[model samples]
Target: MDPAAGLTDVRAASPTTGDDLVTLDGVAKTYTTATGTTQALSPTSLAIRRGEFLSVVGPSGCGKSTLLTMISGLVPPTAGEVRIDGELVDRPYRHCGIAFQTSVLLEWRSVLDNVLLQFEMRGIDPAPHRDKAVALLDSLGLEGSSRLYPRELSGGMKQRVSIARALIHDPSLLLMDEPFSAVDALTRDQLSMDLQQVCMDRGRDLTVLFITHHIEEAVFLGDRVLVMTPRPGRIAEVIDIDLPRPRRLEDAGREKQAAYAAHIRETFSRVGVYRRNQHEGGQA
Candidate 1:
């Protein structure tokens, strides 16, 4: 069967709140690299409902990151348009938060201070969110380390701090590019669970567009998984995760997750697409 045929209209499967929170209509992206012009994303369309955790996966350099940046308004599309909540997106929106493969904490700053950096950058007062930030850290099992510098923390702790920072502003949309890629397997699992809980607790619907190379992780976390093709990428398929909600890592239902993951791997193989750096082992 055609992979595209496998996709169900995401909205049809789940009732959305009013209008879509994010819409990509015939969007495309091109880059003028040293090697010359490169088309990263082909014309594509997608709609993200409010409070949904959506993951995009494809062969590396297939504009996965480009798509993330385009939605975040960090990079302009070469063609077509991007809109958030019916408003055209021409620049980064204040109601957004982002985290990447690395923790990206300021090396000189203490963990608590780094967590507060986002508020300072936006010129927003951190006092109101300070308790929330502290609570986030404590829940992540990093309460005392808040006073320590990023350099003094372990890789997992640093990522925990990064996650805390991203949530400080209460962004309605979170764009994450492999945020847990640097941590160990155990820590990564813990972070995934923690993130789900965080989203559940927050109001105003946290719409997340997460990019990853790990099929299993994508299946495990995303409400819908958008798989993409190779260079000049186009969305290949959108797989709905029908597993029962509130999933934990060690649940017996994990076997079902493995089966869904197998479907992704098989689908990728059928399309002759693979991750850019297999050795990296981390998601995009």
Candidate 2:
């Protein structure tokens, strides 16, 4: 199958502006261990505009996840600063929601309860938000499964629950790190649309920073795609995705999307993630 077949979309976004919601001013990270010092991220600066979907892609061992960590304040930058809504990210930023590749759900909690878990962890009453949780689940196409447990759900279903949980509190920013990597191809496509639909429903109030290895997925979903170089990583390029939104999964076949994907693949080749075998006329 074509690699682009796995692509997906969400909502229509306005062009990005100077109105920044998150800013990284010359931010960098380094670590020193018994093995010695290692630089994880370079002194990079970036501004994430409100309500834009930014997809980041890079070869493994690059600082993709580290970037997310610093932005979320899970770890502080060794140099420079990360500010959210103009405040320093000195600790875990409360107004942000994060989801990883795996759907980290409690096996015991019902689906609706799992979503409400966000409110629970924050020490807030989950009562008023229970209906909202149900609504969220419904919006993601799991309408009546609220009473079910994680064990009863498929991989895709569990991820839907995870996303609902993440967005339940209406966070200004959503950080997803390879959130669809585990699902099957067909399921990945479905989840992509579901994710986009949720973003659309929420409007431009939510900013999404999605990290993935799939170039097609990145091009299909992003307002802008960030290409990162190999470790001690720094931004290689940031490509604007100018496609029409509410994009169908089939849009992956279009010339515009394919062109974007091709450009990203070319970036990967130049960065040595993969190389063409000139003699064999194929990729190495």
Top candidate by lDDT: 2
Per-prediction RMSD in angstroms? 5.1, 5.6
Which regions of candidate 2 are displaced past 4 Å? 1-18, 275-284
Shift in Å, residue 108, candidate 1: 1.8
The list of candidate 1 runs beyond 4 A from truth reads: 1-17, 251-254, 274-284
Q: lDDT tens digits, residues 1-284, model 2? A: 12332222111122235688988888899998999999999887888888989999998878999999999999999999998888999999999899999999998899999999899999999999888888889999998999998998999999889988889999999999999999999999998888888888777899999999988899888988988889888887777888877988898977888888898887777667775578966644
Report the lDDT tens digits of candidate 1 across residue range 147-190. Answer: 89988988988888888888777788999998988899888888
lDDT of each: 0.81, 0.86
Query: Estimated TM-score per prediction?
Result: 0.88, 0.91
Error of 2 at 73 (Å): 0.7
Model 2 TM-score relative to the real fold? 0.91
**Number of clashing pairs per prediction, in order:** 1, 1
Clashing pairs in 1: 213-284
